[model samples]
Each structure stands twice: as structure tokens, then as C-alpha cells.
Target chain A: MKIPLPARFRTPVLLMAGLTLLVALATAIGSEQLNFTLTEMLIRMIVVIGLYMFVGNSGIMSFGHIGFMGIGAYVTAWATLAPEWKQVMLQGLPAFLQEHTYPFPVAVLASGLVAAGVALILGAAIMRLNGLAASIATFAFLAIVYSVYSNWESVTGGTSSVIGIPTVVGPWTAVAFACLAVVAAYAFQVSRYGLMLRASRDDEVAAQSSSVDIVRVRLVAFVCSAFLVGMGGALYAHFLGVLTTDAFYLALSFVTLSMLVVGGIGSLTGAVAGTLAVTLIVEILRACERGFALGGAQISLPRGSQEIGLGLALALVLIFRPAGISRSREL
Target chain B: MVDPLLRVPQPTAAELAAEGVSVRFQGLAALSEVNLTLLRGEIVGLIGPNGAGKTTLINCLTGFQRPTTGRVALAREDTAGWNPARFRKAGVARTFQAGRLFRDMTVAENVEVTGVGLGLDRKSAHSVAMEVLDWLGIADKAARTAGTLDYTDERRVGIARALVLPPAFILMDEPAAGMSDSEGEDLVGLVTSIPTKFGCGVLIIEHNMRVIMNVSHRLYVLDGGRTVAQGTPAEVQANPAVISAYLGADV
Candidate 1:
């Protein structure tokens, strides 16, 4: 039987079907914990896929992308916070920003746009660098952003958690955003610019001589990925109903990066798989720590078993399959 | 065979000239006072011993390197200090010494991407990729991943990539480097067709004397970052300075 969609789309369609099934099953069970876990997985998928859109195609690892998430979370908090709360909490805000509260969707969109704009400015400076230098530059950028957000007491909550963000991003909303992210990433990946960027990533000199415009392509990928990741950040803020700089700092960056690396640093399928696998492993390890019944006996792991076990599992996966579980193969 | 009144006149091909170009790395000069010219529809071979500044000169002409003391003029426009993409947009295409095809893409994509990068629409780029691959006689390998190609096919895809740009001037750097004698002969045949069939100028940097001598209309010999000889292949062959600088020791 002839399939209706073109062959190129089959893998992504299958992937989407699988993801939808996961969401459906989670929602149907009506387990709040399962729904929350699935929601967290979806948000991480958005961020990891967003990271993949740039790092996978451009062949440059960016530690600074989490900074965009931080920016997005803060922007959402700024826009969605009650005017009276904002006036008391963020006195450094300009009168206009302190006066109005926008819709959740608008806040999300605004945060994404703001992060993309910041990416544009940062990429102009950072994309000129290549390889390890560029990676370090991104780390520096992340550090700079973290330092500013950590100390900007009036504009941001500054080291304290910003509260009352309104938990509106349920599992369904998260899945919707994740689906949008997947489509956006797939669309960009197959676009002319994406092809050009990947070409440049594979062989820079050849790409440049072929007129691929390396810097421009890199900048475009950076901005687009930042915007998507920023949206993920907004979702996270609303999901948690609070925000802190630490949530978008090294812990989030490394966890997301580990997920990306474990899944397959080169493919979208890897991103989704890595996020799900890591999240499941973390949950299982946490359960183990809290004590579990096995063979009719109570078994308990150490308190830090989640972190140690996750690290050990990642190491074993890398040792067995250096390219990650996916090995760069896409759906 | 055709009516003279119906045939349109061909526009004269533009000239690409590098005048007194020099490249210095720190205190050492890679290319000093190197001068070369390639006219549209002309095949110019640049031959040199190892480290004779042949590739450096090519880099200068193609805008990959900035000449510290000279200029690259394309159709009378000074193109010195321009990036490689700008040079490509201005119709200067080049193949790398290594066949640096995008490993993940198929053979046809290597060509198609270049065409698209050069401003061809996707539909046209696809057709152009097919046409160019067919023209290069590598049409059968179009669906194969570029990284999996055998040596000769890699070279052909590299040439096909540059040709798809349909450039005004195409530079081939060591295209025949790793080929067998028969393969070199086949490449010579294929490269000889480039200028005439594609209606573009060619600057071929080859270590294979047989290919360079057989294919280029004129040959320029470089030694120690300076042009030692330039003339018809026969004329360049008989030049004593060229012979001593490159050929005498080997030949």
C-alpha cells in the first residue's frame, strides 16, 4: 500500500505518533505524578531538541543556551506576575512593565522573542569563533548571564525564587509545545539554511568556498534554537509556578546536555529518547533511594544514588555506545 | 549547421587577475610577489614542487586568504580581503585539495547544496545537480553517501560540486593527486571538458605533469613563492629556469 505522506516524513510522523501515544496513555491513567513526569519530559524535549537544532547541525556545543531559558523564565515572570506583586517585588522595573500583566501565551511568545533577539546579538560576537574557542565563549556567555541574573535584584528576584507564576502548563500544553518544537526543528533541519549550516559544520572550508556563509548560518541556527529553548523556559516557569536563577544554571545545563549526549548528539530522535531515558532513570533511582519492595523484601539505595547512578549509567552507555544510544540516527 | 542570423553572440568572459600578491605568516612569506591571471574560458595550470606556494596563490585568488601586499581583480573589481562566500557570489568557485564533501549528504546533495548556495532555486538546483552528476559520469553514485565513495568517485563529486555553481572561474586544487595513471587520464579527459562544456575559466593545480601538460593551454611554474615560468606547455617545458626549479631534478 502506498503511504500518503512522502517517504522523508515517515520517520518524524512515526515519532510524533509514539510521543502522542505516550502523552495519551499518561493522561488516560490520570496519575498526577505520571502526568507531571511526562510534562517534565516534554519540556526537556523542547529544550534538548532546541539545543540539537544548533549544536547538532552547527557542530558547535553551546553552554550558553540555558541562559536563554533563564531569560525566557524571567520574561514570563515579568509579564505574567500580578501588577501589584510586580510593583512590590521588582521595583527596578520600568513603570510600563510593572503596570501591566499579559496573557500566558503572550508571555511565552514575548520571552521566546526576547531570547531570540539576545541570541542575535550574542551570536554576532560568538559565531566568529570556531571549535573549542567558541564553546568556551558560550560558557563565558552563560557565566556572564548567570552573574547578571543572580545579582540583578530589582529586575529579577536575584538569588531568590520568583513566585506566583501560575501553573498553567499541564501535560497537554507541554506536549503541544513539544510538538511545535519538533515540527519547527524538522522544518528548519530540512530548510536551505539548515542544509547550508550542516554543510558548513561538516567541512567549514569547503562550505565557505561553496558560498554557504558559515557565520550567517551559524547565527541563524543560534537565534532559532535560542527562541525555541526560550519557549521551553517559559513553559517551565508556568509549570513550576516559581523561578530561580539556579533552575536555569549549571544543573539544568548539564542535565540537558547529558540527555542530548546520551540520546545521540546528532539526531532529533536522540534528543527525545535521551530526555525520556534520563528522566525515567532519575525517577527509578529516586524510588530506589526511597526504598522499594523486591522479592518481598524492602530494598533501599543511598540518598545520592540518583545522581551517582545516573552518572554511572550514562558512563556505561557512553562506553558501550560512544555516539549515545541513538548514535546520530534520526527517526 | 545553424543559421548565422539566429545565433546570438556570446559575452566575453571576464578576467581574474592576481597582481603582486604576497602572503606572510608571521615573519615567513608563503607567497611573495606572485602574479597570475585566468581569463574566462581559458584553462591555466599552476604547477609547483611541494610548498611552492601554489595553494596559497589559489587561496588569495579565491578570497580565502588576504594578500598582504597585492590585489585580486575580477572583471576589474578589486576583490582583495573579501570572504570566500563573497568571492563565490562573484562567481569564483574552487575545489579543495582534499575532497571535502559533506559526509552526511549524498553525492547529489553535495552538488545540489552548492547550487542552492550559489542562489539557484531548489527545483533548479535539483535538476542542475542531476545534470552535473550525469555530465561528470558519476550519476550512478548520486544516491551514495559522499563519505562512502571510493577515491575516484570522491574526486568526481568534488569537481561536480564546483561545476554546479556554473562559475565564471573554477579552481581545482590537486584533483588528480591520489589517482592511478588510468584514473588520472580519465580525470584529465573530464577536466579538459570543464571550460569548453561549462563555458568557464579553469585554474588547475596538479602535481601530475602528464595531466597538467596534456590539459592546460598554458602553464605557470612557481618556486619559492615566485613565478619562475609562464607560456605554452611546450614553451614552459623548455624554459631552463622552470626545469631547474621543478622538473630538472625529477625529470
Candidate 2:
């Protein structure tokens, strides 16, 4: 007799299969023109999936995920930039950072480690407070990181931006990492810690009575999510061939959060669908702005129209389909 | 006529014990100087009027509320400051008064979450959940979301969730509050067999007098956070103290 898959795993397995097909289709159809965009979108999916790990499972919102992303981007930028270029780009940098250039993979891994370490410290304090307080604390953390990245000019290229990083993130690399992220999230959602976190979300009093450590569970999810998001940021930094603190600002944070909310806050498929849909929508909007001139004037749909659209979409989703588009499946 | 206090048997070695346990919130005593023991292989009914501190005592024992004074020893360990996850690892499980099922999850998923801290693998945990559902006669509703279940099935699902963990001690808070007599009987039957079938201790806080009288091996009556009476069904029924507390002293 064939052993049937557990109910929980069934949806995740189907989601993985669907994601694999999308990756394959992206590879095949967009051999050249759409390859770069596809890779970037996949990398963004990684960050959003990481966010889903904590927010989806624990029912807590976090604004600190992008701070970890910023950390990863800068770490990867510092580690992978050549010594001669770094010496010129960052004159007052320490000798070790100015002298060594690690391989891209090593730099990415280091970025994730550093982000996880930061998350561990920050989550200890932030995870203690729940609801809006925790959300605001995390947002404040992002602002703090943004301030440091902007002011610390010598090492981080401070506001001016860092250049000459090798472009190593191609379609396959992005697809592979995205797959890794999805699998990690799947494993975590089914794990003991994830169950406890969800239990805490469902009923705090009963979860406590059952002896679940809510803080510890939240911290685990937070750190794990940060690590993956960091890796995704590192990939984005490498793919774009440039690094800047601006790239990992509040805009990016809001975008990723929108992806999670619009897709389905708690399900994996929601993360993927949200990322793909939001990315495609923004890209199409940008294309429309470039392609069509409104009333003989160059079509400029304001500076942050993309953000406004995403915000409106989020509000609409919350009001109409509160559970998200893929409410039934794990995705 | 049997003396009310004489009919109830003393707790056995495998029972759950609490000594001088007190839970205070902002200087208000929820449970003060409370001492109770629930024996293994027996159903102990905890009955009290609203706000008599029955739920608070249950919460303290199950790790939801930390006692301000004294300790709760389950099986053997001092569980005074233990959190819920730790309590589950120590083989203690519980159900809530309102039947807090995972609204987004299926009935089977609800049960599977209960087996999470049992050190069982996912497949094994799922199998265990299915078995519990089947045992409760709700296996057919396994695929349905817990939120959509009828009140009766939801209560069954709650019981199944607790049973999936196979805990050494189960704390049930108002299992029959909104249930019909038939439904309440079914729940009572399910709870009474837990000790024999799963070899676990049960401490139930209940309001339904018929269910309590029918199922509980022993009963403790709480009035104003104090144990007003403790005895068998017949003895408790005859106890003037319990009767006065329940029906007022006009009789």
C-alpha cells in the first residue's frame, strides 16, 4: 500500500512543484530580455518568504526584516569588492576589510550569519512586546540601521553608494536560492517550534497552559527569517552590480510586506503569488509610464505611485479577502 | 446516610499535586492558599460558581498562570514556573472553556498541533491525531476546517486535540458549557475513559451538575476560591455546605 502524505505537507509539496514549474518557464521563455527581472523577482520572493516565516506563523508583523536585508547587502558589498577598488572607494576602511575579497558564496553566507546574529540580539527585546508595539519597535530598528548606513560613509560608501561588485546572481542562482528558501520555510512551518508559534497565535492562554514558550518560538522564527532575507539581499546586491543603502530602505520593506499581505499572510503559496503579482504589476506600470506619454507630456506617474498602488492593494485585500488570495493553501 | 466528606477517596501516588498554590493578579487573589490533588486513573470534578477561582487554579496547574506561592508538581517535577511548552513536554495538556480550535486549520490539523511537543515525527504525530479523531468518532470530519464544525463536533475536536498528546495530566476547563445534554454525556464519556484508555490523570472544571455527578470519581466544590466540600456524588448531593452554596440556604 502506498503511504499517503500528511495533510499539512500536501499543500506545500504542490506549491513547491508549482514554483519549480514557474522557475523552469522563466528560464525557458525569458532566455535574455526577462532573465534579469525574473532573477530579481525570485530573489525578492526569498525575502518575502522569510518574512512569512515569522509574520505568517506567529501572526506578528515585523519591520526589521529589511534592516537585516540592508545588513546583508552591505556585508556582501564589503566582502566581495576587490581590495584595490575598496581602497579607493573606502579610503578610511580598516586594513582587513580593504585587503581581502572573498568568493561570492562565502560573502553571502557571512551576510546571513551577521544578519541572524543581529536578529538574535534585536528579537530578544522586540519579541517580548506584541502587536503594534513590536511592529513599531521593528520599524524603529530599520530606521536606526538606515541612519547608520547613511552616516557611516567610509566603510559603507555612505550615501554615495558602492560600485564594481561582480554580477554573479543569474537566473539559476536566484531560482536555486528561492527554492531553498521555500523548502526552509516549509520545513519550519511543520516543525515543533512553528507549531508552538501558531498555537500561541491561535490562543495565547491555552498555548501557555500547554507549556509553549511564545517568546522563544517567535525569536527562532525571527532569526531564521532574518537569515534567509539577508541571503536574498546579498543576492540582490550582487545581481544589480551596485550597492546602496537606498536600495534597502523603507520602500523595499513596504514592498515585501505588501507581497506577504496580498498573497496570503500565513500560506507559502501566498508569498509566491504576492511576490510575482506585485513584481509584475510594478514592472508593467513602469513599462506603461515609459511607453506612453500622457497628453504630449512625458508620462510621470508621480515619484512613489508604485508604493501608493501597493498600499491601496494591501488595504483592498485586507478589507475584502482578509485571509489573502490563496487563503486555503500553504504555498 | 453517608457522610459527604467520607465518601471521596484520597489521591493516589500517580496523581497531580499542588501545595499552598496561590495566584495573585495586581494584589487581587485569584487562588489563595489552594491545595488540591488529582489522582491518576480517576476523574476529579472541580465545581464552583463564576469567578470562584476554578479556572485560575487550572491555569496555574497547566502553566498558564504562575502561582505566587507554593508549587505544582506533576508526576514528580516542580512545575511552578514552567511555561506551556515545557508543561506539554512534561506530559500535561489542557482544553479551553470556549473550545479554542485553530480556526484556519482542519480538524485533523487541530489534533496534529496537540501532538507537537510529544517528540513524535510529523508522520507519526499525524497518525496519532487521526487515531484520536477516530476514537472520538469524529474521523469523518477530519478534512473540515475547525471553524465550520458544529458545536458538538468542535467540542469533540477539542477533546481530540488534548488526547492526541497522550498527556499524563489533562486539565479541562468547562467542557460542557454550551453543549446539549446528549453532547455533554458524550463528552463526559470520552473524558471518563481517558484515564483507563490512555493511562492519564484528569482534572476537569465543570458547571454541568449532571455531567459532573455522572462522570467524576470524586468532586471538589469551590466557593470564593476555597474548597467548600469534597466527596462522592451521593455525599456531595447530601452535603449541606455544597447545597447551600449551589441553591442558597432557603432549603
lDDT of 2 by residue, A181-297 (tens): 988998998787888788778877656654467788889999999999999989999999898888888788888988888899978889988998888878876676556677887
Candidate 1 scores an fnat of 0.66
**lDDT of candidate 1 over A1-331, digit per residue (tens):** 1225667786577678888889999889999989888898899899999999999889899898899999998999999999999988899998777999899989999999999999999999989987789899999989988999999999998998899988999988998888888888888887888888889888999998888888888999999999999999999999999888888888889889989988988888888889988998989888889998889999999898887877887898889987788888776
The DockQ of each candidate is 0.67, 0.40
- Model 2 lDDT per residue over B117-145, tens place: 44455556677788888998988888898
lDDT of 1: 0.87
Measured against the true structure, the TM-scores of the candidates, in listed sequence, are: 0.94, 0.90
Task: Identify the CAPRI category of the predicted complex in candidate 2.
Answer: acceptable
Identify the candidate with maximal lDDT. Answer: 1
What is candidate 1's lDDT per residue for B25-107, written digit by digit as tens? 99898998988889988899999889999999998988888998988899888875689988877788889888899998878
Q: List, in the given order, the native-contact fraction of each candidate.
A: 0.66, 0.48
Best by TM-score: 1
